[model samples]
Each structure stands twice: as structure tokens, then as C-alpha cells.
Target chain A: MTAPSRHALVPFVSVDNMMKLVLHIGVERMMTELAAEIEADFLRWPLFDKTPRVASHSEVGVIELMPTSDGETYGFKYVNGHPSNMKKGLQTVTAFGLLADVATGYPLMLSEMTLLTALRTAATSAMAAKWLAPKGTRVMAMIGNGAQAEFQALAFKAVCGIAEVRLYDIDPAATAKCARNLAGRGLNVVSCNSAEQAMEGAQIVTTCTADKQYATILTDNMVGSGVHINAVGGDCPGKTELHRDILLRSGIFVEYPPQTRIEGEIQQLEADHPVTELWQVIAGQAEGRSDARQITLFDSVGFAIEDFSALRYVHSRLKDSGLYQNLDMIADPDDPRDLFGMLLRAGAAQAA
Target chain B: MTAPSRHALVPFVSVDNMMKLVLHIGVERMMTELAAEIEADFLRWPLFDKTPRVASHSEVGVIELMPTSDGETYGFKYVNGHPSNMKKGLQTVTAFGLLADVATGYPLMLSEMTLLTALRTAATSAMAAKWLAPKGTRVMAMIGNGAQAEFQALAFKAVCGIAEVRLYDIDPAATAKCARNLAGRGLNVVSCNSAEQAMEGAQIVTTCTADKQYATILTDNMVGSGVHINAVGGDCPGKTELHRDILLRSGIFVEYPPQTRIEGEIQQLEADHPVTELWQVIAGQAEGRSDARQITLFDSVGFAIEDFSALRYVHSRLKDSGLYQNLDMIADPDDPRDLFGMLLRAGAAQAA
Candidate 1:
């Protein structure tokens, strides 16, 4: 048996290191790799221990813990969403996650998943669209123009080969900021005043708005046939973006049925409403878009397996990266039964 | 409105810092404060959200997330237990926890909970004993001389005014270590070979043996009437310390019914077996010790609110103590909608 060392430190990746690592790999290239990782995990979806997130909801916001394991490694993310937090100069959501060894239950890596969640959500959305959206789609109508707008644009560009993004938000300043950020990024970025204007000549319609109520950002008249809709913002209960009539006419695909029934756009439908599992399509057991007139919709609610895939991808890249710090997180004693002895030694060391 | 600064930082207390803080406050004093905090929270138990822990069980061990909130602050502990880990020279249980602001969903503190959990578990045990044990209880028979043995002795001394501790274990070296650790800690410590010898002339009996099977550490004939039992180690399924006949004769008080029914000693009983919630006792709504000769048992499976109280106590002590370091764990953007802008700036700074 190998002797256990006195130092049982876990590697920690802070927001700064995460940003540096992403820039080092280039954002688009990172998104591509993350998409591939997510796709690979989705292909073997039955191997995972899947559960919908455990959420603690209050009047103002909700905090959730999403956990999953693949018999080898376990991962969980702690994330919170408060819409009014943006008015208080805080990001609407913040997150952190850890990956642990299944044998010992010791945390292996602790990472800031705020940025990684954005990446994984976008990667998941684009991956779904690759199997659902029309072929050779070059234009995406972005209806949110907020924190996730640029990521959604880049993910589709890198994963689904989109060359143009038409952006619009209720707030003109948000559209200006998005247009300024995506300038000279090799895509035709157009700013529009109305959601209908952004949808003009668009083959992929992405509605990602920020609200806690059931107000329609997309109406039935705005959605055209033969286009794929990536509905991003309506993730939690009582929060949806599309009208009920629009959902009735489209073929909806979901990440997980039980969760989507409670938190996704399909929450508007009956609990037993039929929706195709995206993994089934990716695994070649189900069909994607069948004809030119079919309207496909991806009710994009994030799941634990996607976060596991992102953490797995990060762990694979963390090897020899020199981009992390050691966190003295675990108490390691010489004799495992002598935890008191370990504390006493620390007291003595301080005295010396 | 106060100007919202573009900075979001979380305080982190490492294992070293936790030891320093504990020593600074004195372990017994910290235990006393933690007991007080736990008692205070238990008094208002109906106001908090209570749920059984979210657990992921594997062949070797189990990892669990215990979460609770008091409407203002949210706390959760990530803990693991594996009995065979000690043979591999690793702790059988290790943990960490986070406390976050409920309004904005921002993490406020992250602390290593391996040592803190030890403190809180002992504190909770002693606190429960104060209400159930016979008056003027001065001698405690600690029947498992393991890592938790010393803490249990000290907590009883600090909280219940115990004057002597009798230690016993199957392994003589464990008993020796417990005796050595408690030599100058103001209480008299005695090492014994067997449980019967340890329980002689003792008013309180604490069985905390670390085994994963339903082994009898305490028998029916050995546990005399009028003695309170603090059962701490039988915290998982298929793990029990006292004989079923002994449990049948005792009045059991548990943390949470749904949890204690599965993990505590009461798992051997029928699903609707009569057990009282300890919070009801603390709240003066239920009976603790009905008479001096009645056998009272506190079946503690360790609830989430106890961990919350411990974290609350530590967070209060952390103010201006310089025992914690700031971790840049949250993403703070000048414009909450401009997360992409923040990443672009980071890239520019790295290139510059």
C-alpha cells in the first residue's frame, strides 16, 4: 500500500486563473473543445447518476446544488440566481463547483464555475442546435444581448458554423454594448431595435431574456417555420420567454424530461407532454428535423451532466498547466484515527 | 443608494486558520459558544427550512450535502464518510462548507469543516445531554477512544460540568492516545480495557465506536436505568452501537425524523416508531427526561441546522480577526450585463 502523505491539498482554480486559461486556449477553440466534451458525455448518458438540481427558492431568487457521478468521479455545482442583483451591481448569477474522487470522496479540484457555466450552457445550446437547426445556417437572431448573448453567438459560430448575428434587446444600451464587444470578430453583427427586426432573414432564433415572470418575449407571429429556436432564459419555474401558442406549433427537444417539465419552457405545457430527449438524437436513436417546414425548438434548461463534462474537460486540461494553487482544505493526520493528535501538533508548532 | 463597487470577494478559512481561531478562542469556550448558538437556533426551528441531506452513496463510502437556511443566510456542508479510509491512513470523515447571502445569493464565507465538524458534533452531543442526562452528572463513560472521543469528553466538561471521563476501546492504543490527549485538559481521564469497566459508577454513557456494521458496543444488561446515552457513531445505515433491546427500553430523541429514521440507531425500529424531535425539547414543547430513573437516549444523526449554527458562530468570530483570507471567487462586472466585456478586458490585460 502507498503511504498517505501528511498534506492532502486540493488544487484550486480561481476566476483569474480560469480567465487566463480560457484566453490561453482562445475562447472559440475552448468552446469547440467543451462542445466535444459535452457531446461525448451525452452519448453515454445512461452511465451517469442523474438528478435534477436541489433548489432553495425564496421570494427574490433561488440557489441550487446540482450533483452527478459517473462511478469514477463526482461533481457538483453551487449556483445562485437573483434577477434584482444586477441592479445592485452584482452578476445575476454566480457559481463554484468541485470534482471529487468517488472512492474516497475527497475533493480533487475546486474551481470558479461562473465563467465555465456560461461556456457550458452555450456549448450545450449549440450542440443541440447542430442536431436540430437547419443545415448551412449562417444567421442567428439573438434576442437577449446581455451577459450570455456574446457567448451564445460565439458558441453557434464555432460549433454550428454561423457567420452573422442579429442582436436586439428591450434596452438599446445593451444592444450597443453587445455590438461594441463583437466588432471585428469576423461576423456580420447587426443591431436592431425590435425582436421582430432581429428575426428578419434569420434561420436560427435564440431568445435569452432576463426576467423572473411569465412574460412573452417571443410571440406566435414572430416565429417562422423551418427555423430552430434556442430558448435560453426561461430556466426556472414561472420564468419563460416564448408564448404558449408558439410552443404548441413547434417540435420541442429537452435535456432532461423531469427537470424540463418543472423548469423549462415545456413547464408551460402539460406535465406529460411529449418532448424528445436531445441525447436520443445525438445517440442516433431519435430523429432531428425531418422536413423543411418543421419548426424545431430546444427548451434549453441546464443539467448536471453538462457541468460534469465541463469539469472533466477542465481536469484533463489542468495537467501540467501550472495555472492553479494548492488549497490546504483537508486535515491530514499521520495516524488517521489521531485527529486530536493532529490538532495538538499544530498547537505545538505554533508555539515553537 | 450606495455605489455598488466592482468587487466581489469571499472569505476563506483554511484548516490552519481554523485551528488558530479555535485556539485563540479556547476549544472549550468555542464549544460553549457553539452549544449556545445551536440551542438558540433550535428554539426557533419552525422558521428554518429543513430537509434530509442529499447523499450520493458508492460501494466504499458516501458523500452528502446538508443544506439549511434561516431566510437571511444559507449554509451547506459537503461531507464524506468511509470506514476503511482509516486503514489507508486517511480520515474516515472530511468536510467543507459555504455560507452565502440570501438576498443576492453571493457566497460570504468558505471554511474547512473537518475540524469544525468535530467541534460541532461534540457540542451538539453535549448540548443534548444537558437536557436529557440526570442532574449533576459528573462522570462520562466514553466507550470509543477514537478521534471524536477527546472532543466528546471536553464538550461534556464544558457544557454539562463533567469532572471525569472513562475511556475504553477494542484497541488499547486508541484508549492510550485518548488518555494522553486529555491528561492536562483539566478533567481526570481513565483508560479501561472493556466497556463494562468504563461504565462503572458513570452517570452518562457515550457510545461512539467507528464500525460500519450493526455491532453491539452496549448491551441491555450493561446500560443501567437513570443513565443518559449519547449515541454519536451509528450515523449511517447498517451501523448501530446499542443492542436492539436497549433501544426498545429507552426514550429516543432525534434531530430530524426522516433522516434519523434511516441513519440513526432508530433505523432498526418500525417506520412509525415513537420518537421525539429534540428541537421540541429545546423549544419546551416536549419532554426530555421524564424521571430520574428513566433511560433517555439522544439519537443524533447530525442535522444541517447544527452545521449552520457552527458556521454562524465561526463567521461571528472571524470579524477583524485576520484569521481568514479573501478569495476572489465571484465574478463582478462593472455592467452586470457585460460579462463578455469583462472577459475581453482580461484578455487585453494579459496581452498588455
Candidate 2:
């Protein structure tokens, strides 16, 4: 059999290649670079065609398709959230994304986003912390040390110059695993007994627990004044990580208002409750942190543009890193109108 | 590198494998089987989660995502339509699709839909014709001789017993290419000079021209009584093939009215114009052909459920055919909560 044409092939970055890419570029540097790409896109957020993700919810889990375009390039991510999957020895969330040229609508690249999602989520959290965290913040109380815990810790160390990450999870094994993962990483990792102990002297607190419920991982008394809360866990309709009281007192900033009102921590608040758009803040159209003692919350419900940025970043690295395999995913006929003829020829070749 | 776990591997049927599968099963037989699968799905249509395709339109083309689920399995197709892409020596439409398990939210298979879509679209059209076409329909006039023309011809022959096909295209080379490809495929292929000549003795008139504007491929005078008009190419907003007068005279049947209203030939009619759901007809809940001489038009806009049916059909064939490769697309960790640890281990293995 003859090799497929270049037009028929799409560059695919598998999980192994993605890890190689990350380790080749170094996770911290890659996160910093990914954050820069995301920040640049956020700065021009109005140009994007943004819509709340299209989600299909079942009794067991939810599957979502998040698509966005900036007129020139279009991108979408297929992601699934199944909290029970972990018990079945499957990742709670797994994702993959595609980037296509707007002109021809041909896919430019396909990448495994399970690893990339963790990296981008942490990078986004750290990017928000760069704007909303208290000035001179040196420590981050990492609550809910699950799959995203170590990435979040490293992103803080790389992006926000945090010297330490205090880890805590309801399950002690989770906390211990997180501490072990971060042992050799350039950050002070602390395994704490409780959420309260994790927050001791911390100016930034990142909540990334993976419960598909409205259970509050942080209550009113647990939060301190002048702290920035990077809320990452409450991303679905009925799932919220912070308490309603915490939301009532904090000045919240979100990725997109319509989506955040439905999926973010602000879902607990009234529909019309005033909240700032994170893009506007990144673009200097709105304030991020006003006073040193004011509570600020970056309600992060991962958006399509962030995935687009990650896709763009990975595509940029493919030329130099050589970390992708081209799969014969598209059917390209030499004569555009002779698709049937192409099939006939392939059959003839096989017969020969 | 270590072999990825079963959880991480997604079975991918590339374009070559898809062609092999198609040829191995034989095109006519595959289309007949696909028609049966589509018919079975249509019979239980209301049980599926249905939605209009999510589309992103650009100046030269449009990119669309069509997603659907049947409570147990979820599927989606990523397709692009660029009418001008042909001038650039590219296929006017390219597609790929995925099928996933709703229970675990994990992808089960990914396949190139450029060929599968052609098969399914033709299968769907033929399936609709089975219920709506005049009894013992033999000759079909395929108006547009593009990439989809031969598929439609063979599917009609296999599904509806079309023994003769009269073909015509504005570009004579396309008609010639289609005729050459369909030469040995058990049908009397007639190359016609005009649309009127193509419909001379045809019982089913299929219009599938690929102009991205309001195109009258079949005018009122061109269509006759008792004919099953399978209008295929008037998909996407502002692109219609038949004249409104012809539409007013026909008993229209559609697959998903909400989408057909915007992207089908009925886009030229009133928003509240009466149209029968083809699924209802297939399920025996609605009438298909009321009289012998009545004009019955099956307005084919293509739906997510058709693609879902195709994915399901292709997935069923995988176990027996073994015409697929496992792609390391998902990141599966031993502990599920250790996605970051998986990355760390991969990195350490690389370093060693």
C-alpha cells in the first residue's frame, strides 16, 4: 500500500508525545509560555466567537464540546467529566482538542488534552493569581490535592513566584501522593492535616477538588481577609467548591459571565449579581485587585479559548520538538471531484 | 516507551482502512446495511438526544460540529463545507467522527467520516426514499455529479432498486468522472446534456449541486408528478437547490425540522410550512406516500442522528473486520487521580 498524501494526514500528539513535549520544554517554562498565549488571547477576547459549552448530561456523567473561533483559526475540545470514573480506575476528566484553519476548515493538529488540560488549568489559575493574588504573596494553600494539585503548585512557583504550596485533601493518601509528586519539584510542599492548617499564612488559596456536588470545600470562617481564591473545582451546574457566604463577601472575576453564572462558583449567587469579566481585567478595562485587604476570587471554569491557546502553543512547538505523528485522517483525492475513483484505485491496488 | 493501557487506546479507522472496509464489504452491500442501520435508528428517533449542528461560518466556508446520543452511546462529527475549496484542488467537504460510551465518558472509536459520511448521507437519502418514493422506482436523475453523486447512485440501486441513473452537471468533466467511476457498478449510466434530459424517464430526481448560494438546480417546470425529489446539496443557510414553486407543489418530508428549516430547500418557504418528520413515517406513525401521482420530496439536510447511526454501524464492524489501529490518545494513569504522576513517570523514564 502506498503512503497517504500530506493533505490526508493530520498531525497528532499522543499522550506520550505530549509528555515528551512538556519535559523537553520543561513543565514550568511551558506553563509560563502557555499562560502567555492565553493572556494574549484573553487580551483580545472580544474578537472570539464565544458561547457556553454544549454539554450532554446523563445520570452518570456529562460530555461537553467547547468550540471557539477568532475569525482566522477555529478550535474545539471534546472533554468528559465522570467523577465515578476514578473509582473504576479511569481518569475523572479526559480531553482531546483540535485546531483547524478557518479558510479551508481542515484540521491543523489533534492533541491529547488530558495532560494538557491539567497544565493549562493550572497555568490559567496562576495567571489569574498573577492579577488577583495579594501583592508579595509567597505561599498558596492548595486545597483538594487531586490530579491538578502538583501542576497548580508548580504553576504558582513558576508564574506567581510562590515559594511554597500547602496541600490538603479529605483523603490523606491524596495529600501524601501530591506531596510525593512535588518532592523534587522546585517548591516547598507541605502535607497538611486539614484545610485550615493548609491555609496558615497563605495569601493565595487554590481549590481544585473533584466532587460532582455542591459540597463546600471552603466555608465562611476558613477564608481570610485580603486573600485571592483560585476556585477550580465547581465547574458544573450543581457542583460548587466555595460556600455561598464566601461568594457574597468576595469580589469575583470570571472567564465569561454567561457561562460562569451557570457553571462557576458564582452559580451559587443570583443571576444578576455583579461580577467582572476576566478578559476586561486582563485588557485593563476593569480593575483586578483594588485594595490590599479586599477579597478577590478567580472563578475558573475552563473555556474554549484557553484550549485554543494550548493547541496553538503545541502546534508552534511541533516544528522544533518533532513530537507529533501524522495520521491519515482526511480523505484527499488527487482530482477533487473523483473521490469514488480514488476508492476504486485503492481497491485495484489492493487486488494487485 | 511503554505500551499505553487499554483505557488510553482509542481505535481509529483511517481513510485507507475505511476504503478497505467499504470495498471489502462491497459499496452497494455496505450502503444497504448502512441504510438498514439508519432505518432502525429512525424507527426509534424520539429516544435519541437530537440537536441542530453547531456551525461556525467564515467568508469562504463553514465548520460544523454535529453531536447526538442514544442514552447509551454518544457520537459527534466534525465537518467542513468549502465550495471554493474545489478550485484549490481540495475536496469541497471533509469530515471525521467519534463514538464514545456515555456510561464511562470514554471514546470508543474514531473514524474518517469523509467516506463514511458520503455512504451514510446516501444511505439516509435512500432510506428516506424507501418510505416516500413511488412504488418500484427504477430510474434516478442525479442532478449534481460531484463527490457525492456516485455514492448516491449506488445507494439508490442497493436500497431502492434503482436500475438506471441519468446524470448531469454544469461541468461536463464531473459528469464524465462520475460516469466512468459508476461504469461497472450494475446500473445503466446515462450522461445527459441538460437537467431536463436527465429527468426524462426518471422516477426519483436527486439535486445535489454544490453552489454556496440560492441555486435552482430544479425549477418548477423541470419536476413532474409522482416523482421522489431527493434534494441533497441545498445544505447550509442561503444554499437551496429547488425553486420555491416546486416545493409548494410537493409533500415534503424532513429529518429534524428545526435544522431543515434553516439549511434545506424549505429555507425558501414559510417558517411554519408543514413538513412531515421522516422518522415518524419510518416508525409507521406518519403517512409517507398518500397517492401515486402526488409529488413527494425528501428534503435531505443530513442530521446528527444519521452520523450517530453510521458510527454505531462502523463500530459494530470493527470486531470482525479488524481494519483499525489503536491510537494512544487518552492519558490513563494507574490510580486515575495520578495524571500528573503519570506524566512525571513518563518524564523519568525518558531521562533514564
Candidate 3:
């Protein structure tokens, strides 16, 4: 009997390998490349098959499956958000994703997305900020300095040319951790005691707290004109960060309106509230940062296409990097229709 | 840094390991046990979160993600069907699946499900037949003798009281392959040239052809009264097996009605076609095989919960069986909020 061919093997990047890959590429350069990949996808957004994530919400948190295809390749991410997990020494969010060939429906790669999600989220935020933030913006504020804070700060510096980042969080240890992690990251990092202090001299304010309730992390009084607000924490139906008044004052931009309406800060507004699709702006079909004093807010609810781009980028990177292992994942018989015969032969091989 | 806790490691069953597992457990006994697990889940169908399988369709075929939860355990299957793949010497259907803790959203097991899906599909069919087929069903006619034919025959012998299987395929080579595989499987196996020839004195007929279009593998006159027809193929939109006249005559039962309307044999019928939910019939909430003259049809599209049960059953079986390897699939930091620190430490450890 012919042995299972190379078709049965799928390359997998585990958490250890993912971290190795990130360190090998250098996080800042990875973020910049991810930003470019995301931008390229956004430019060709019309070619993508988009759908709102299918989520299973429980009392603790939610698990979602986000899938998309760009006609040639298909990708999906399995992600979870359980804010209470942090108290138990577990990440509030965890993820893994897969990329597949559209022609044969074969999985190309599977990778842990906990780190990649952070990179993509920050890259997406920086991409939006590049389009919507005021001209000559150099200072950014990172509120709720948790696991994503350093990634956000580095991504902004790498993608949007931000020179300094001011960090603030409700917990002092989180702020200290963020400050220490960003010590040598090529950016001027400042730790602030209050959210208002973090926003001082900042042209961009990013909120990424791990709160599961409808608490206002960003209010109308705090957001000034011409500053872009990247609201990242509020990504569920009952959980939001920005106030309704802040949403009314800002011209909101979203990855997908159908999803943002149900999960983003705009969930506080009317269902028909006018919001620009970010892809249109990136594709040059709509205006971005129209005037000097325009309050442009990207109410970012993560989308499937961004994950697709990340997976595609990682799959392309596998040729040069040996940080993956081949998994005996697919069952391939010598003759495709003789699956039962293959099983029998496998048993006999074990006996032999 | 502290070592990652056990929760961070997910058990992964590879193809080689799964084949060993099936052989160790004994195939017929495993299928019969799987039928019981499926029956138990079906009995509590209302508790599950059910949705139509999310599919991404290309020109050649389709890839689907099927997810369902019983509020405590969440499971999903990633499966692809490409008829063109067989011509290139690949299985027409290949799959993998995951079972996760709903409370924490951490995957407990990642398994190669191509073999498992075949097991579950055959098991589920035998389960449905056990509830809906006429009394004293000792013989079954399996048309389309391809990959699933032997599995269906064995499952029926183990779950129901079937003692013989008559097989027929459009391609004589496929029938010969199936007959060869099932030669010593403790059942009377017959190979025939035509579907009508195989159906002689058969009480059940199972159609499982691999076609992407609406092809009639089973016509009206070929089906007799009181025979249970298990239609396994034609599971996607614009694909079906039995002719429309047979569907009109048979008392149809389906897994999920909304999904069936788009992808089952009843797709040939009206949108509002009156059909019994198979779970309700199994739970004694509805009737199955009301009379001897009635033709019963299980228009199976394969639901998410059945895969959930299959995964759950597999997980349960993995406890004493050391048939899996731990994958470092989740990133667990000493401090959950310091993911950057974890990556930096990983890099340092590699360098050291």
C-alpha cells in the first residue's frame, strides 16, 4: 500500500512556535507587515465574502467563529473572550486560526492566534488611525494598559509614525507592566495615573480594557475634536466602552456595520445610525479625515478578513522560517474511495 | 517563569493515532457506542444551540464549519467536500474537529475527524434507522458503494439487527472495492450492477453517492412501501439523491428543518414541506413509522450536535487510552496581563 502523501500533512504553529516566529521577525516589523497586508486586503474588500461572526455567548463570555474567503484562500479564527478569566490567571482572550486552499479545500496551516490577534488588532487600529487621525499626529494614548497595551503602542509607532505613547489603567501593576515592557521599544513611553492624564497631548486615544459591562471607559467630556478614538474593548452586545454622547459627536467608522451595530460602541446608537465602512475609505470610495476638527472614531469590532490576511501572511512566511511542525492531520488512503481498506491496513501494520 | 498549566495543553489525536484508536476499540463496537451517544444527545435536542452549517462555496466545492453547544460543552467540526479532489487522488471529504469547555472556552481536544466523521455519519444513520425503520429490519441495500458503504453496513449490523448488505454502484469498480473491503466483516455482502438489482428483498436502502448536482441515484418505482431510505449525499444546496416523486411519497424526517430546506432531499419539495424533526420522534414527542405502508425517509444533512456528541464521546474514551499528544496550543503567562513579557521570556529562553 502507498503511504499517505504530503497532502495528509498540515503545518501547525503552536503557541511556543508562534512566539518564536514573532521574535524571529521582530514584533515591530511584523506589525508593520501585518498593517500592509491588512491595507492591501481592505483595498480589495469587494472581492471578499463577509459575514458577521457566529458567536456562542455564555454567562462567563463568548466563543466566536469568524470565517472569510477572498476567492482563492479561505480562513477562520476560533476566539474566546472571558473577562473573568484574568482573575484565575488565564488570558481574557485566546484564539487559534486556520488557512485553507480554496481549490482543494485542504488546510494549509494552523496557528495559535493569541499573539497574532494582538498584532492584527493593533495593526488594524494603526491602519485606521493612519486614515482617520489628524495630520502630523505624533502622540498616542493607550488606556487600560493590559496585555494588548504594548502591542498597541508599538503598532502605532510602527504603522502610523507615533513617537510617544502615554499609558493609563485602573490597576497600577498593569501600568507598571506596560511601562516596563515598552522600556526599549523605540517609543517615548509615559505612565499616567488617570485616563484624562493619558490623553494629554495625544492625537489618538486607544481603549482596550477588559471590562464585560456597559461601563463608560471613554466619555464625551474626555474626547476632544480632531482626535481619533480607537475603541477596542466594547465588542459584545451588552459590553461597550465609549459613551453614547461621544458616539454622537464623532463620525464613526467600522469594519462591518452589521457587526459593529450589534457589538461595537455604536450599539448604543440607532440601528440606522450613519457610519462609514472602513473598507470604502481605504478603497478611496469615501472621504477620511475630511477637515482639521473632524472627530473621526473607528469603532473597531474585529472582522474575519483581517484574520484571513494574518493567516495568509503567516502561511507565506512559513517557507523561510522553520518554526512549524507537520501534523498527520488528514486521512489519505492510496485510493481515495478505499477508506475502509486503509483502516484495515493500518491495523495490520500495527500488528506487524 | 512558571510552567503552563494543564489547561494550556490541548490533546490532539492525529490520523495515525485515530486509526489505532478505532482498531483498539473494535470498529463495530465503537460504531454501536457512537450510536448510543448520538441517541442521548438527540433525546435532548431542544437544549442545544443549533444553526445551519456555515459554508464557504468556491466554484469546485464547499468548506463548512458546523458548531453547536449544550450550554456546558461546545463542539464544532471543520469539513470540506470537493468531488474534484477524488480525481486528484484525494478523499472527497476531509475533516477535523474540536471540543471545548464552554465555561472557559478552552479547547479540550483537537482531533482528525475525517475518519471520525465517517464513523459518526454511519453511526448517526444507524441510530436514525433504529428509531424509524420498520420492525425486524435484517437486510439493507446500500446504493453508491463508495467510502461510506462498508461503514453503513457494519453500523447497521451493530446498532440494528441487519445481517446482510446488498451493494450496488454506478461504477462497477467502486462496488468491487466495497465488496472486497467488507468480505470478512461477519455479514452477508452482495455486489450488484444496478440499484434495483441490489434492492431485492431489502428492507432499508441507503444512498450515499458523491455528486455535486441533483442526480437521481434512487427513483420512485425502485423504492417500495415500508422501506426506510437513508439519503446521505446531496447535503449542500443544489445537491440531492432521491427523486422528487419519492420524496413526495415518503414520510420525511430531518435533522434541522431550516438547514434541510436548503440542502436535504426535501429541497426538491416545497419550502414549507411538512416533515417531522427526527429528535422529536426519537424523544417520543412525535411518531416514527406510523404504519407498515408508509415510506420513511431520513433526509440527513448531518447536524452540528451529532458531531458534538461524537467529539464528546471521543473525549470520554480518551481518558484511559493514551492515544493523544498534548499540543501547546494556548499561551499561558504567569501574569495573564503580561503577554509581552511571556514572548520576551520565550525568546530569552531559546537564546539561553
Q: For this target, which candidate reaches the highest lDDT against the unseen true structure?
A: 2
- What does the interface RMSD come to for each candidate? 3.7, 0.7, 1.5
lDDT of 1 by residue, B120-237 (tens): 9999999999999999999999999888988899999999999999999999999999999888999989888789999999989998988899899999999898999999993899
Angstrom error of the Cα, residue A346, model 1: value is 1.0
How far out, in Å, is residue A206 in model 3? 1.0
On residues B174-265, what C-alpha lDDT tens digit does candidate 2 reach at each position? 99999999998799999999999999999999988899988888889988899999999939899999899999999999999999999999
Query: How do the candidates rank by TM-score, highest first?
Result: 2, 3, 1
Tens-digit lDDT track of model 2 for A1-352: 5678889999999999998999899989998999899999999999999988999889999999999999999999999999999889998899999999999989999999999999999999999899898889999999998999899999999999999999999999999999998897778888899999999999999999888898889999998899999999937989999999999999999998889899999888889999999889998999989899889999999999999999999999999999999999999999988888889999989999
Better of 2 and 3 by TM-score: 2
Lowest lDDT block of 10, candidate 3 chain A:
A1-10
Which residue pairs clash within candidate 2? none
The DockQ assigned to candidate 2 is 0.90
The better-scoring model by DockQ among 2 and 3 is 2
Assess candidate 1 and give its TM-score to the true structure. Answer: 0.98
True contacts kept of 3: 0.82
**How well is each residue in A1-352 modelled by candidate 1, as lDDT tens digits?**
1222444688888887788788888889999999999999999998899888999988899999999999899999999999999898888989999999989989999998988999999999999999999999999999999899999999999999999999999999999999999998888999998999999999999999889999899999998899899999937999999999999999999998989999999889988888999999999999888887889999998999999999988888887677788887888778877888878877887788
- Model 3 CA deviation exceeding 4 Å by range: A1-3, B1-4
